[model samples]
Target: MRRGLMAWDPQEVPASALADRLARLRAELAREGVDVFVAYTNIARGGSVWWLTGFTPYWNEGLLYAPAQGEMVFATALSKRVAEWISSVMPAGEVTTTPRPSAFIGEHIARDGAKRIGILELDDFPAGHAQAILQAAPGVELVDVTEAFARARNDSDAVERLLLTKADALAQAACGAVDVSSAHARDFIAPAESVARLGGAEECFTLVAGDLRSSRAFVRTDSMGSLGETFAARVSLAYKGAWTRHVRSFAKDAGVQQSMDRAHAALMDFSLQSGETLAQAVARTFGSLGEVNNWVAEQPRGSYPLAPVANMAESAQGFTASAPFVLDVELVTDGRRWVGARMIGL
Candidate 1:
């Protein structure tokens, strides 16, 4: 029997569902007497920009304009295509693609008859943006909503449950490749040539293999080709993400196998003692409200006892299994071997 990190997509949250969520968020802004909520993204916000429009713009800026009295509108410095996509989420907002985002925003605020303004950033925004907004709407109540916006944006999106499902699968494939390489024969062509081969197909795996050939089994490297070694990974302990998809094909090390045997026995003992299977533990973790962003942002912040599955609902045209579950979990034998659960599902 097999079970592991499953990848999946939740479902398309309708525009109305997104609107309802935005209404709830906007209502919170209104309660705080926030006249508007402004946010920008050169890349990704921790969560802010995506909350307003179902789209998190890359290489652009996004804004959420809410009047205490009228419908909230989203603003951005993206093309009409981008605006149209966001319009599906917020039918009332406008989009622009000018060079000076601050100036464009200032002009829009003034033109739209805004009186009180709540900018998303007071510290982060350039002084010029503040000056422009003030020049455009001088008499208006100009306050900052950066903190409020930050807190509001932290809430998870229901649609993200679907994206994470796909993310988990990608993470699994990476993990699978890692496992395959790790347990494969440690073939060191040499330092003279090892550096050159680091960026090809097996860069991530070979870089470490070369260092292990030269240094102690767990020594670290600064750079081996394009694979810049960041830190030392503990030899026996597989990191959460690293072990999520591929089971180490067992390197046949006596010590490693012995330790594995002990761990397996311990796991079986625990399972019988607790009256639950490993699958039950995973299910509990899955239900932990950590269903967003590859489940990387697990709420209440506790690592799942196993390597957290990266994605669990994304597959092919339907529910086809695409990743393995590498349980760093344990199973103990009567006295011979160790055991851990796995997902060999397609």
Candidate 2:
């Protein structure tokens, strides 16, 4: 029998813990000779900001600024009414809705008189905004410190682990809700969404796979169409500030089971392998997958649901023991069977 999903509480990290994070981050900034650190986020890439500030951007652009010595400040492009509601999470300031968000960021830098500033995800940040911020603060120097910022957030605190576990349960529940035998893939959306909501998740996503020959990587689609005789469904959800995923398949034949067993073992090895670069682990674990199917074991394929940022490193050479992450792996058999799984790494 399939094991039941784990139950999780709805609690979150407290303010005192957030304050501790702020202190540590500021200390790190001092060591780097950066007078201030600015973290930018939209709907995606909010993980670093939320990890430190306990505030996630619901909509629009979000910015969090931390000085070497002072209370951290949170700002966003949201209006006054929304800012008021957000004050409970973090006292938010208004930034005018403009293409160049650095103008407001510069205003904050000028207000703080920060001489040396560091921005996270500098490589991915817009060039125009970076130039605007530079123009706003003529005397200040800007540096890309995404690596430093990501390192600081690598270790998951106790509260963070709890939230992730809860997300895992919700994801399992959502997967269990999918009806792979249905004629229309859209039929699974409602129950999956309801299960996620009832389980206290903030967001839910569901995807269906057709026959193995035509199965594609998970993508959001609105096509309400029938699935093949053998199909798979994947469900993922976000709870509090964490994310997790679960995949399920139903087959009319035993050939799929033979392939799934092989793939699942490989995935287990991939998830449990530690103290190695992500590429090395993948090569060692799933190298045989290529023999079975056309699948290739690739490196640097990892992400965080809490902060869905773009362009994360493909190499996992620097993953620390405490840093929480997920390994998303999928495979297909030559006989036309689909299998996918995501394992949490803590």
Candidate 3:
């Protein structure tokens, strides 16, 4: 569950911006001959809904229904007591809280004689909700519109870019707050989480790699043993509805630290141009720093908050230029491993 600030700032995300996003989505739906579009939202995968509406569900789950011409409606399983609060944060035309949100949405859309319903990430949508919708509107044809939704959401608006920048800054500050001198890995948790929460993060997940030599896998724990010669921490944060990640590594040896610092400088200076692939971009930036062991790029796609779009292993999936994404890299310098990640593409 989210444990930090959860308020909507109209100054940051004006109502007009939300309306424009909805309009673009509806235009895509029209091209697909879809009468209405439905998107599912949970605490885990709700980027699509958050991109459509300013609201992100802290717990339970919800559904967003958008018609071709009318305003969008949100139905959630949350209690009625929080309906007013949800409305204050969400810019949906109607907000209803009920035990069975799918049934409510099915009945609501069926009343409008919706002939073709478009579901985002339909393959991964809950089976029970799909059944409920089919049970209510037996004649309505349900079609998968994940591609359409992705096309509609491909463009990153200025407001979202600003939010992502703030989120990345928060993650960097949180990771920077860690006490590198501490011997125990547990000591790194409190300072990072505290800084992120105090910095207006809606959610923060901090992972610590006690030792890079033994393993590079990051884990969330408070009972870690003593740190080794090399340690690293990764902080993933959500500000408002935008998400970002930042990773930092530490070293006990002065020489190793210098090498890591050089590699990090290269990462910070990296940029991808219009016709450049991620592999080409990495090689251009980090070719002289060290051996590029691995790299992966992620972006908000479909229902996933951060889905892998491009990676070293899979070069087929290309990334969009000037779109917000997180790039994680692993470098090997003189047999020493250094891993770092940051939000790129603004």
- For model 2 the local lDDT of residue 147 reads 65
> Per-residue CA lDDT of candidate 3, range 1-346, in tens?
8768998898888888889999888899889999999999998998999998988899999999987777788999999999999889886568999999999999977898999999998899999999999888889988999988888888699889989989999999998899888888888667999999999999999989889998889988754777889888899989998989998888878888888788888878878887888899998988887798899998998888887888989964746666888999998876888899999988
Best by TM-score: 3
- For 228-262, candidate 2 gives per-residue lDDT tens digits of 65666677666665666666655645675566657
lDDT of 1 at 339: 21
Q: Encode model 1's per-residue lDDT on 23-80: one tens digit a residue.
A: 7657767777776655554332313444444443444565555555455555556775
Give the Å shift of residue 216 in candidate 2. 2.7
Better of 2 and 3 by TM-score: 3
lDDT score at residue 245, model 3, on the 0-100 scale? 91
Q: Estimate the TM-score for candidate 2.
A: 0.78
Listed in order, each prediction's TM-score against the native is: 0.49, 0.78, 0.97
Question: Arrange candidates by TM-score, highest first: which order?
Answer: 3, 2, 1
**Candidate 3 wrongly placed segments (more than 4 Å):** none
lDDT of each: 0.39, 0.61, 0.88
> RMSD per prediction, one decimal?
12.6, 5.9, 1.2
